[model samples]
Target: MDSQQPKQPKVLWLNVIVFTVTFAVAAIGTPLWAWHHGFDLAQFIMLGVAFTFTGMSITAGYHRLWSHKAYEANSVLKVIFALGGAFAIQNSILHWASDHRIHHRHVDDNDVDPYSANRGFWYSHIGWMLRDYQRNRYADYTNCRDLQKDKIVMWQHKYYLPLVLLTNFGIPLVFGVLHGDIWGALILIGFTRLVLNHHTTFFINSLAHIWGKQPYTNKNSARDNGFLALLTFGEGYHNFHHIFENDYRNGIHWWQFDPTKWLIKAGSWVGLTTKLRITPEERIEKAKATMLLTRLKTRLSVSDENQRRIQLIQFEYDALLARMTDYYAMKKRFFDLKKRRLLKKYERADLLNQLQKMKSELQQQRKTWYSLAASYSY
Candidate 1:
């Protein structure tokens, strides 16, 4: 269903009540309470708790687990994350994920992309939500059938309104009542924190497309901004994500501080997630190869080394792909033979040893290509 000029009933109410009440309370109630009483730190604590739960839930739970399916989570983890996301006051998992999949599928398409970058910053930031946009809001359940089957996701989707209100307002008020500072809680934790969270998440949708290096595919508008990545729990690498959506990590390098990736990896230790798919190193090398060719093409008319550089990168990429295929084939055969379980114990153990050698060669080829790329680059 497409959004018309008619008002969005739910967003209308939420915007009026939450936004108005929050700001009004912050502006009027805070000063009134402070004037009557002494300084208090209760609201700040509520704000901290709100930031922690909401931020983690968005990055780890909603975006990665539910939207991207980077990995699966246990029921306890799922519920906890859903609760945390609710506290953030964003849409429910179903609503957010469906929109996101559509966004990725038709990014920059004026009609379909919810926050299409081509429409300009103002439209992409929060303007899309302020209007009815009833034209683009009906989420296609086909893309989210997996999420549909999940009980927690359904629960969160069905009871989204109350959960959002509870986490956004009720939780803070409870803290305020306990600490005897109702206004402070409403202001700092409820309003200010919500405002800040809104921008941080929206930054990925707006600022990310507007600035930074398009080091991967230029087909999309997404760009990688390291500084933004720091603010967005590593989602600032928008260019890489648009290119490599299936990778478990956004910040693929060791230095990039993607806490969401770290969280999921850590959870794997406790058996909460499995088959955590990662893009093959060879595939990443191909992306780098594409980036090299793209840069070379752009620099061709200006530079003398353009042709040589592109040629070297292509050759190195092909060689790396060949080596990677051989390694995987060898490893798979050894594993398959061993898994038959009919093999003698000693023979199965020998197969494992052979597979280990192939892995070492894979590592060596990876390094060889990396050195080649680095050494050639000026």
Candidate 2:
């Protein structure tokens, strides 16, 4: 299967036709009825539940658990996400993760990145889905080998298109029929929810790259925006994600609106998942300091006064990094001894002191550096 790419489906026509009809019907049929009857509170309730459940399924299950291996979930969550992703009407988890991995690997490269943000916001957000610009449809498989190995991912991939049509239309139809509110259910949950979910997810690919601050790293197009993060279940912290993609948390800050992160944390509590890996605080601070240095350097090259300030910063920054390193290294050494079955009361006290010192040093550096950036107009 690695030797050849999957054939581009002639399903483009099918997609166009089906989407057109689906949208048209929901757009016309439901609203017309609603105009005569008016919107019901129950319909919104169903839409809310569907959107939240299915959205989390994609973020927590497909992106975090399956794609990034940030954590592991039990079969129950796996099945739930599989079904929710299907109901969400995004592609299968395998394909979504596959394409996402490729997007990361060749970001902004029009020829390789499946949804290259270089094509502009609208194109990246929605156009890529409407057309095929990349030659290797399966290019992302390289980064998603683990997902391909999963039985659920494989089954979801195999049954995606059928499942998409079925769940999107069927569930609403069944519920609407049962509730005697067919038009409202179809319009509210089926189409509106899909459009909203699709666009919201798409923003992470498009707007996220263009609209946020790069706090952790500036090496990539990824960014962090509070508004986008809110809309995307904490995925708006694109910069952090690009810098540390393997962490189960996207919005690691105290108030980042990352429901996905919370869900994973909740899962861990319930014993449904484990091995959640987060980048160390020291590492996070280091990246922030490096980016500050890089930005200062950029500004310094043009301003002599700023250059003097930056020169002063270079020496102080190096000293701080060394302090952090020594602190962390000693801490690691102490912990490793205990990890190797050599725990001692004395060692525990030593480890606590070392860890506290490292944390304090990092905090001090961040406070001073951010203060410097705030004052440096140049």
| Maximum-TM-score candidate | 2
Candidate 2 weakest ten by summed lDDT: 9-18
Candidate of highest lDDT: 2
Report the lDDT tens digits of candidate 1 across residue range 1-378: 977795443455555576566657666766676687644565566677787678879988888888888888899899999998888888889988988988999999988898898988987987777766645456457789898999999999999989987887798798888887776777777777777677789899999999998878889899999998888788898998998887779999989878888878988999987768798665675676568656655654535565676676667666767777777777667767767756788977887787787778767876876787666555
lDDT of the structure predicted as candidate 1: 0.79
Per-candidate clashes come to: 6, 0
Query: What TM-score do all the candidates reach, one by one?
Result: 0.79, 0.89
Clashing pairs in 2: none
**Model 1 TM:** 0.79
